[model samples]
Target chain A: MKLMRLLCWIMVFCIDVHVKAEETHKEKCDFNRGNCVILAEDGRRVFRSDEILVMLAPRALLEIRNENTVQLVKGDFYIETEQPVKLQTPYAKIWCEGECKGLFSRTAVTLEVKSLDGNWRITRAGEKTVYVVPAGLQVSIGEVAENGQAQMEFPQSLPWVPTIKQWASLYPGKVSEFKPELEKFRQVWREAVEAVSVLHQTVATRAVASHEAEVEQARRQRLAQLREDQGLRNLFRDKNP
Target chain B: MPLILYMRLTSFLCFILVMMLGWMQLYSRAREIFNGTSEIKAEIGHLKSTTAHERIAMALEREQFLEFRQNVATLMPDVLKSKGLGEEGYPYRSLASSISRSEAELVRQTIAKTLFERAKDNFRQEKFPKAIHGFHQIIDHFGFTPYVADSYFLLAESHFKQNELEACTGVIQEMVELFPHHELTGFALVRLGRIYQVQNRNEEAIEIFKTVMRSFPQRDVAAQAKASLKGIDL
Candidate 1:
């Protein structure tokens, strides 16, 4: 037990050093978490966690500090990373492991995993069997022996589990006295939609402008061709005559 | 006199013939330029012009972009009626038409950011209840998104401020569970330990602080956890 504790201490020390080193190299770029940002490295990932635990070396190595990882313990997390990394759930030691680069989330009753790039597999603990999870497919890997099939439906939506939306009837999360005040953000939501729409419009406009410039250039070239043909004909008449 | 007049007529005829020759030469030069063989080579030096279909598509996109930008600009009133603050005016202006998926994602992310900031502002202003509500909304709407984690942490803080220990505990537990390797997890653990201490659950608090020391030895949270443990021991 002493030896194990010593090893754990050494590992934590090494990870701490590694985390400090990454502070200089990684920039968050386009990455974001909630309304704030934690790490700015690589800009391709987002990390959402309350704390670090588990057998993994460190969040820094996995680029989790910069949105490269999805911590689905509290809520769902979506991130995109160029670097290849594998995922292990809290029950990863007992359940499964696989490459991840997409959306991953969990509720009290179920864990869902989806990959956008390609297919990956999650193997059962201490078993030879592996479950292949294809890209764009969502699956809830029900307990270890549940035959690793990916399911499309979320548990919150199931008849038995009620969500905040269905809480008047009964829900999964603890019942709260205060509602989310969803109605309050209505105007901001509308503005958000409008902002996105406008941004798209700008892109389309630029594309059109580029195309128009090309057309004008083509017209000039055509006119030049016609003029050159006329010139050549006159020269030929003079020579033949 | 008749001999002199005949000489004048010959000179006039010679001048007319010279003028005709000059006219012929000028016409020939103009026609060569018009033939476009040399001009074509000169004009298309580097540019490989786009196809007709491509040009048409671009024109259509440009037209749509203009229309969309105009429409979005006029979309809403600058002032929004929020829950607590009625008819609050936003300072920024609106912009629109991207055709690519990546561009669309960028726009979506930008909007999420705007909403996230608004929620954060509520927290910074000491409006704990309103902030908690706002953060919850973000998590509910944008769960599994980059905003979810931030919302979770802030929501936990909001609950902590309101002295809602149970709710705070639940939020922190969720954060730690979801993000076992995140930096905030260390902070959450520390917070959890403090809460435990407040409740006089010394042993449980010690365990949580030890977990932080074992997991994140270099974090300030670890130091705080160690201090808490020492305080408990003394």
Candidate 2:
């Protein structure tokens, strides 16, 4: 037992020493979550939690051991290092992993979709499949693909999830008298949906009517051509007599 | 004699071990130096490639500009004379055409840059209308540039500035729609919270702020957003 304890202490001491050594050479670059950026380093920047995104810069290594989800919106990025990263999420669609280096070169396009089930899959639609972001691992979707297959880049997590009562308290009048306000909102939404549907139908009807009119005009022109031909024949006969 | 020999052998072994350790350290240091040199070389190569491309592009632009200037100079006198007002009409017409074309191109580029600068200035000054106009001009005129995303964000900000809550929200919604993967996504979210705050929608503001803090804690704006969220009633 004494030997084992001593070995454990030595291990801890060695780890501390290694950490200090690493810190001596480590430099940090500032970045925002959910925003694409160029990482100005060779080594991968480690993301510490599932609630945050570590915007991977161009050619910068992204090391995510465990994260809830990673959203990729636009830009060209690569995960070229040999590090095993884990993803834990449901319904994620950003393509960011595997032996492939995802190259998204479109000006404004998406590259992947993320599921909530801890799966990060390739999603560049109608473009070369550059990277198959590894399954069950966090990914950085910075590449812009021509196709809009990239899942919406959402922040890894919401900072605070308020309870129903707490949410109600945030707004002075809206949440306090919640039921009526909700009903009113529902009524407004329904009206908006109905209005939009009606507008669409009206446009469709107009288009159909215009097409029918065009067809009718073509028929009338053909009939007029036939009548003109017959009139010329009759006039020729009278001239001959 | 045996005892002395044993002592000497022990001392020699110790020296050899120390020397081996020193040599290993030196080898590691040299390896590190080699790796750093290679990295620097790669960076320099990349920079050189980029510089070469930039130089070529600049040369092409300069050539085009010079050609246009010469054509206009040659045509101006002819047009004035042809006008029968003691001026060369043909040369002037040709000159005017060439100058007009160049001026049009210049205006397009200038308008884009001007809009970008104006938006930034208006944002700083809190002059929402001018900022919105500038951003709209960029979007309308320079949709092909990468600055279109920026214009969308700026337009959203303008709507927010005018106290058009729904309009601002709608514009931001469009921005997110158009450029879901843009670098300014986080900035747009931050602006959304600020708009909510102005309208006394403290809860919504707090929610958005919290989202920024939790999702983008590393962002510069996130730091301010986080601090603001803490002060909210929620």
Candidate 3:
């Protein structure tokens, strides 16, 4: 009898260990947002979009149309997946088929695949038409996305980030009374005041102008409805340049 | 008689031991079920709370961005027309450059502010090209000025108003990324989504709206995004 009781206790112990192991192996992602840091063997992905359906099981499947390689929905995503992260839309399927980092966005006319530091793929849905978008390059799919034009729009934008960095150099540290000859300090404070007061005055004037423009627009609409409208000619009063 | 009683007592003891063992197994199974259910429930509660928190924060951020834009729109004219400090005039940096270094800094600020306001006013009055030029001046020459963020946004807005969708997309993307965590970022993201919708890229629009709903679930923008999603065919 004692031997049988001991055997039953051992069985329960084994079952509990198996259950705990299963919980750890199965990846069940939380559907709610609050500083979610997606961790994989290789790297991490921080989500900033409002609507994303991320499933970690069976290869981290995001929402995509099953009928085609193309996705029915497209939102901005920054991915650094351990394996390749594939994005399917109705028009095309984009994947960092290579190991790397990238940000993908879709617009009204195009699926813009911006490979920040990796080689991404753009394959047309229902067809094997593929475009290899290399590192530091952008590829678009749609009416505006031509075969060769993607390479021409290089050095894509102004130095917005660098510009902010340079601006930060002007920041003056906290000034104490002992630090009297702080010319830069005084200067920073002065400009801040000037900015506030001048901006306030500008906003007030704009409000008044906006109100006046609205009244004028309404009056013009009334007149146009009564007579034969000449359109562009009516809105334009040519002034001396 | 004593031998018969001994056998019966032994059998009764064996039955009691078996029943106790069976009860232990049942209790263990019940405990496991109860623990697993509670764990799942705790997770669900955490997720619901987190989503609610995200929604409230997003709403507040969006409201703040709108308020700032409206005030700045009205303030543009006032800044442009402000008379320089009577004789302590800081018109262009050219005059201040000849003076002390500190004076030059003041002149630069004044000039950048003046240029930004003029460009913004031109935007309000529907003068797209000139507005673009003025905004670029603030970005190029006075990158350090407080006007940089506003200039970037207005520059994109000017392009958008001019029907330069391509340029608008790029600039708004730049704004959203370079100024992450700023209130303007929310507007930029939403505007980007709308641009996609207008261009008939409903799938992309849906994706954007979904992201907004997930990240800022409690916001009116999220609700608007839901409406947008429903309004779209898919």
Candidate 4:
């Protein structure tokens, strides 16, 4: 009886160890949002136009067909399509196997779908322009204007400029003591820019005047004085000549 | 008569022993079932809480980003006009460069705030992958912002949520390595030790929990760690 009880205890201990080992192994594979198991039935699952799929696979060529539209979030496998595909994102790089028909949001998230056929036309809103997306082209959202000009655009800049009051609060001084000096600096800067604008406008408007030479000379003189007042010695130092 | 009495006593003692052992086993089984059910419920609650928080946070971020875009759109035209350029002729590259550093600082703060919110919400939602992605985005885009330490904490939480407890160990391990003096370090360490406990890796859990108690004696996490150590029974 003693021997039988000891055997039973050993068996229980072994089972417990085995269960823990299994749990640990299960956790190992489920680490990377690998939680979802896509079954064969998922292939037939129809996703709606607004449904976005972020493919986790590094190298997957997903073949998705939609009657409406789809947005592929960043870090998804590229889509290869035979039909014209309309992709909307800040930008998209799609490869078309057949006719490429799609609209892209002109915002930074533009659709760049590649096509097997070299013939393609890009329409921004209503403006349609015939263009060739080479067999393996990667196009961004914006159009390269005529003359092959690329307009370099920056991302949205910052908002909420620190007011003089806001800046003063960071320091140990009272607002009354600080505001006047800051305001004076701002006013001086504004006046200096206005003086430059006035000179430029005068030069532009007097171009067809009979006293054009006189206007030009006066504009130069004014620019020189304005530059001096603003302590911009390099700007109009030679204008005295 | 003596033999009969001795036999009766022995039989009585045997019966009592069997009854006591049976009761002990029953009590142990009940305790095991209760503990197991409690853990399952706790996990379920964590998932539900995380989902709700994450949805709200992501929506908030998207709204804020859109607002930022609109504000920039409205202000850009004015800046372009001041520069003597029509919308088409705007020297965008130059104007962008001329934007003051303080302006960039403001944008960074907003982005950081949004990223942190998304990360924390995802962590709460038990969506570890999404939460990790959010933290990575914060680290990638808002690396210069004040959200770095918080991002690390969220990343650790994300890994923990997925039951990638081992993977989580490495992340929190890195967190401690990277942010040695971070205010939340003890909390993270205690949580990491709990992951070990959940896996029945009691020795490692006890070691780490003890370390937390020693290192962060004044912190509440340390107290929790001490309480957790009581369960290890070693």
Local accuracy of candidate 1 as per-residue lDDT tens digits, B1-234: 998798668656655655565567667767868887557766565343335335434543543453343233223222122221322222221111132223346667776777789889988999887888788877776664598788888888889888999999999989888988777778878888989999999999999989998998565867887888898899
TM-score of chain B of each: 0.56, 0.46, 0.53, 0.55
Q: How far off is residue B66 in model 1, in Å?
A: 20
State the lDDT of candidate 1 residue by residue for A1-241, as single tens digits: 4544554554444342334453353343332332222322232233433322211111112222233332233234443334333444422211223333334544433456544334455543224456655443345643222122222232111121212232222211233532342232233334444554575588779989999999999999999999999999999999999
DockQ for all models: 0.00, 0.01, 0.01, 0.01
lDDT string for model 3 (B34-152, tens) is 77975787889999868855754564454334334333333333333463345444442233243224445777898898998899899999999999999988988998889988898
Clashes of each: 54, 53, 24, 20
Model 1 regions more than 4 Å off:
A1-241, B1-100
Model 4, stretches more than 4 Å misplaced?
A: A1-241, B1-98
Poorest stretch of ten by lDDT in candidate 4 chain A = A39-48
Compare the candidates by TM-score and give the number of the best one.
1
Q: If both were scored by DockQ, which would come out higher, candidate 1 or candidate 4?
A: 4
lDDT of 2 by residue, A1-241 (tens): 4544554554444342333352353444232232222222433333323233332333333222223233222223322212223221111234323232222211122233211122234433223344432222223333221122223342222112222222233222334475774454345444544654575688889999999999999999999999999999999999998
Q: B210, model 3: CA deviation in Å? A: 2.7
Score candidate 1 by TM-score against the native: 0.31
Please give the TM-score that candidate 2 achieves against the real structure.
0.27
Return the lDDT, model 1, position B98.
Answer: 37
Docking quality of model 3: it rates as incorrect
